[model samples]
Target: MDRVIYNFDSLSQRQSAATVPLRRSIYRARRVPEPRIGIIYNPRSHRNKGQDLACAGADNAMVAQPRTRDEIAHALAGFAREGIDFLIINGGDGTVRDVLTMGQAVFADRWPAIAVLPKGKTNALNVDLGAPADWSLEAALKAYASGRRILRRPLAVSRVDEDDPAMLGFIFGAGAFTLGIEAGQEAHSLGFFNSLAVGATGAWGVLQALFGTNGNKWRRGTQMDLRYLPGGAPLPRSKYGDPARRSVMLASTLERMPMGIQLFGAPRSGLKVAVLDRPRRRLLAALPAIFMGWRPRWLAEAGFHQLDADAVAIDVAEPVILDGEAFPAGRYRIEQGPELTFISV
Candidate 1:
């Protein structure tokens, strides 16, 4: 199935370091004393497979390579018990999502400051934090000791029917957005990543919808019952379009995305959303401006809806992608999650 989140074979796939052209210059810092930091390293991230993270030299640095949720929670619990001052996430979006999701149970309120070494296939969070592809633990430790940091809140998603606590992440999307990620995985296999992968996948998806026959998956859209949370009112249906069908629905907490894409209009905080009520013929030509964050005055009337959301209730029969992973179809509540401080230097 195209919508299936991941393939195990792909998880262990390896690519030569020279092939990825994002950034090769390593960010270094002068000698700085390390603080008590627990490092959750993902050996499976794109850049971290064969190379060991070089933080073992620091006296206060502790590293854990956890392969399961239980192990992640256990590691975080140990960190919390030891009262580490800084927590370093040494992977990309998926690893970061896993840490935040499991760490919530271990650090409920008094969360430790985090520093991410963006080594994932898609490092959107790192892009927002201005962390380059070569950002290192040494640089992060220097920034931390210098007291430089920024705050960001993750998106908390919970099924309305389940008793489980909300899953925390930075990006969330369903419908066509899910398709885009599926294409992105293929792009990654071809040795393209970050902005190039994002652009290629997006172009492929758009071209398919534009040239494909009627009733295609992209054109048909997904059946979703979306309404604002705590209010229970539906978003107004577009002119002559089905109220429950949307071609694209994406939400994010980041100010800047890969390839400089921002469907939510401008760079602002909180949950910014973009939902399109199915694709139309007129939309084909406007793709360039739309991807560039341009919003025409008549766009809202044509079914392109941008929302600054507090919370939303979603009921759909298709899988939704959070970060780079997928969740099954069901009724879900999406809201702002806990605020966390991160070192930005």
Candidate 2:
């Protein structure tokens, strides 16, 4: 856990410290007035090369290398103190979540807009923002310098207890699917095909475990009470809730999944919340939908609702993974927060 923090007076000052070759391109753009920019990067992040390149491309970007989760929060607090106008996060989903969580506390006044550089195994949030999957620091800076506008949408935040603050952006889910993410991280560390490959393998492992002798271990499924607020209908409680019903594999953005597949519906479907469910069918049903776009319909038929609400709540007996971070094993509530605005290329 390393933390580096800097405050530059101008984009030209930032360009001077950039190490990427593409920084020159972004340096030529018009400079905005003292736009205090704060950047958080994970030193141990997998995509260091891309992050380095993106850092080199930005102007007047203050870089922080936070070693621990709390350190990252402190660095964000410093940025807020400096009155940062924009925050460019240069890591994967986990890093983004950490920064957003810190931002809510340090920059609660709706200042410091966020821009993302997807440099992680599963960049679901980056993909949603339409940022380049292969984003280098230089490319990211270029996009910002080229006058690209940032889009703000609501974010889903959640927490398990009063002592813990809510997580920023994304949903919570349990069952085999959530467990698969854990397995995928292990496979990824063991030299697998990165996050996407790890996810695929993890899903397979879940399937195998479900049918194996130990399958009965997790058979005592927990209960999930979902309530749609603002006058939406309440879902009827069912005894055997489909594992898929308890699970949600959704990307809040309009982009495709990392595997180049459209897990949600269409690009236009970006504005709406996409929910895929079917506990009874499990991955057996989701596999076909990934390749053929046919399974989501079945999931919808099984009472999986896809609402455009900015907020939602999930109360469960077991712990749920929001984005990629795991919370305590107990009931939790998730609701949509403010929308993160980004400048896309």
Candidate 3:
């Protein structure tokens, strides 16, 4: 039996049509074949508790709920071998990160279009992709079958050493950003999760960095050495303020961040970076304009540095936050990865 798959894009139009024959005529007029889909679901994700995975099963769709990283790798290998046209991830940020890292071997030089269901505590990537929290796997598969798509690139961070593995995700941060992650964890413990927790923790971090004295860890900042790649010139330390330390450092391939904040001055497509030196007198006032995407002429002179770079080397004194996971401190090379297609509408 050939199952009829409806195009999500035409759902509104089909529903408004007066008669069944008219809907049938529209369907026949615009019918397109469905693509083979593969779903990798993580049951342990925050919002995935007690969720139904059986609904994802279909004639052309394959759903695999993998419990371990090794299982995820194996599933991706099988999907690649089977030649799936689209891949849907049904979990949170950590699940997405793990899949991208483990599936790298199976998807070398070739990637199927991907879609994500926002099922996590903080779906930052999904928020940027404009996927709602209630987005379902069935709806996503339908979207893959016929709806519009948005292409995005992810940031790839790896240890400087060739032997070490690489991690793929949207956001990367250190210095005060690292401390903010710790505070965010505390906020989560107090029943403040999601976007509220993010904003609260961020506001607290900024306040601590402002009023706290020079010796405060969050204020004193971390020691890091940054060198631009392709040409190994050392990044200007004087531009930030203190040559030995920086208060905050962050990089992402995402244009819009959580809480609808525009962290970068301009909407850059690739890897974008923002760095701040130890607090200057005008640091408090400068933050508001920067958050609004304002490109004030004195931003750099006020010890705020933003740039778009092909690659950067970061040797840090502390652990950094990638997505929501904590990565060990080391010398890391950050670069942009290939463009990936994501479902929308």
Q: Of the candidates numbered 1 and 3, which has the greater TM-score value?
A: 1
What would the per-residue lDDT of candidate 1 be over residues 51-130, giving only the tens digit for each residue?
Answer: 97697445667789998666777788788778787899998898998788877667665677898998888798988888
Q: What is the lDDT, from 0 to 100, of the residue 314 in candidate 3?
A: 94
Candidate closer to the true structure by TM-score (higher is better), 2 or 3: 3
RMSD of each: 8.7, 9.3, 12.2
**How does residue 265 of candidate 2 score in lDDT?**
47
TM-score for candidate 2, please give it. 0.72
Which model is ahead, 1 or 2, in terms of lDDT? 1
Best by TM-score: 1
Give a tens-digit lDDT track for model 3, residues 1-345: 011211123322322221112111211112137666788989988788887775644666778999866678778877877877788898888789877866666675467788888777778888888877789877886776677677787888887865545677888898988788778778877877667877888888878777888888778878898878969787654464468788889999987788777786666588898888776647765676678767778777777778888999999988887877777677889998656777865
lDDT of each: 0.78, 0.54, 0.75
Worst 10 residues of 2 by lDDT: 1-10
Clashes of each: 0, 19, 0
After superposing candidate 2 on the true structure, give the runs of residues whose Cα lies further than 4 Å from its correct spot. Answer: 1-34, 49-60, 152-154, 160-164, 193-195, 202-206, 209-220, 230-233, 236-256, 260-264, 267-278, 281-287, 290-292, 295-299, 303-307
